[model samples]
Target: MKIHNPFRTALVATLGVGLGILMITSIQTLSTVILYIGTALFLSLGLDPVVTMLERRGLPRWAAVLITILAVLSIFAAVVLIVLPVLIEQISELVDQITPLVQNGEQTIESLKGWMTETFPNLAVDDVFAYVTDWMAKEDWQNNVAGWTETIGQGVLVIGGAVLAGLFGAFIVLVLTIYLTASTPSLKRSAYQLVPASKRERFIDIADQITDSVGHYVMGQVSLGVINGILSAIFLSIINAPFTAVLAVIAFFFSLIPLVGTLTGSTIIVLACLLPGVGSPATALAAAIYYLIYMQVEAYFLAPRIMSRAVSVPGAVVVIAALSGGALLGLLGALIAIPVAASILIIYRQVLIPRMDQR
Candidate 1:
């Protein structure tokens, strides 16, 4: 006899599918809200120590929150004011230089062909140049330009919408952060009351440890990115590379991605150098090689030393975490991978290891 309840089964299936659809829709519609909430929580944790310090100095919680937010906004505004125009100019120059750079590259190829034909008498320079020029001319640059323009126009609309949504979400998170920070003690007390009396202290300790771990990781990552940006700018300047500032900024932003970011940044820098006519092919090759070596050194020496202090997870664990995180959540997964791994390690150390030892 079939004992299945058809109504119950249908309800369960419908609920599951509905929940999946809701999640997908939320990712698209409320993405800005998610981003804001995450960012605010991260920032709130980092600023907590400062807030506590201010409280000890006799300032109210609201005053501390106001001070922190104003300080952050002021610094952000300063950066935009100082850097935005220069970045815009550099980008415009880079775009304007592209067509001329391509023409020069074609000319360079033709010159090399001529030399090859002269050195080896049987070589056909005419056919080679003809083929090269034809290929270059057939690049459909106009179509590409038109397509890029269309894409940019669409991107602007999407970005504008996102920005508006982000602003709204940010307002909400800011309000929530102020309230949460002010009521943190009461919130903790309430949370602890929910737990069994025996485990209450242990739960609080675990929660605090997790908070500290995440806070340190965020601060460390930001610090590392800044250092990388400054070092990149200095190196690019020494090499007399065009768009040094722009490349530095790009490097800083991309360096947020774990292992692969440096390589990506270096590739862009090398390609930019190649276009500028300042570096010969040999020089470009040397630059790429130099960057690869630098990346290796940074990965092996700099990253471990910097990140070890922030998150105590081992190298092997970090690699596995990064890979798993990337697979799971793409960029966001990778960004928080180390911290997530550290949390797991913390849990294992505090709970599992202790239990195992006792047994």
Candidate 2:
């Protein structure tokens, strides 16, 4: 007689659901790991050429790695030394000035309102002022300030941890870079062997193109960001803008985000300048106009020249990639969008373009 397997079925069903959940959790964790590893690997790949050149001059792999790591660390240290003190000072100043700034802004608005009332006698200036003062005095305002302070404190701690992790990760990447660079040819051959003999050559070719495109794009963007930062810093210093160092650093990071980034940076700098009484509204307006013109030149001339030499991605594709990446992943996605787009473009050219041509 055949017995019903109700207990076995229930056990199997429960185990299956448990395993599915575990698998999903594992995949999420794995994805995070892969993202971190991929970032390090890409950096390693970009630095590999330098390692190769040194190795060609008879330097041992270990020595090359040490030198590369030292150079990176030294540059990082120098930047921190040059910029950190200024940033800290600016931040402290900003915090101290916040209350006074708010009071000044309130006064400015009130003065404007009074003028308007005198010009147009029917206007309710007193009512407007009362509303503004009430808004400022609200419980919500205090809550917001308290919340902001807590968030800032937490952010500082997180940043400290992230910096430590980044330093450790950099060391790991340096070692891996040296090893990968030294064995790149062998690695290529091994990778090619994994493909069927008929497809090996094509696969290798596509891989090489992708690597070159992505590496060049990354390097070019970094170069452009550095240039923009230096130029911005010079301009800010010449103009005697408050927080010039902080604003320049902000410009540099934002410049990594492509089209809208520079505009955002410029607006921020202009607003900060307005607060410090360094410029009248008209002067701020003039600076903003200058920034717009400069951005146009940079976009049309500087960007195209640099990007064309680095990667052959189309303008339309870059815009779309930036918008989509920004929408999906905020600033991080925007920063990597161009390289990601270039990689996709490489895949399309290598894989799909030929297939379409055949058809």
The alpha-carbon RMSD values of the candidates against the true structure, listed in the order shown, are: 5.3, 5.1
- Which ranges of candidate 1 are over 4 A from the true structure? 1-32, 52-60, 99-187, 276-309, 323-330, 356-359
Tell me the tens digit of each residue's lDDT in model 1 across 1-359. 68479899889999999999999998989866676666566666766666777889999888887787677679778877877887898888877766665678767666566556755589777887788668867996656988998999999999999999867876787776766666666776898799998998999899788777776677667766777788888887777778777988887877876666677878887887765344445445656777888788788787777666465777688778888877976766777787778888889999999999999
Clashes of 2: 0
What TM-score does each of the candidates earn?
0.72, 0.76
lDDT of 2 by residue, 210-270 (tens): 7766666666677678877898888877777777888889878878777677888888878
Top TM-score prediction, candidate number? 2
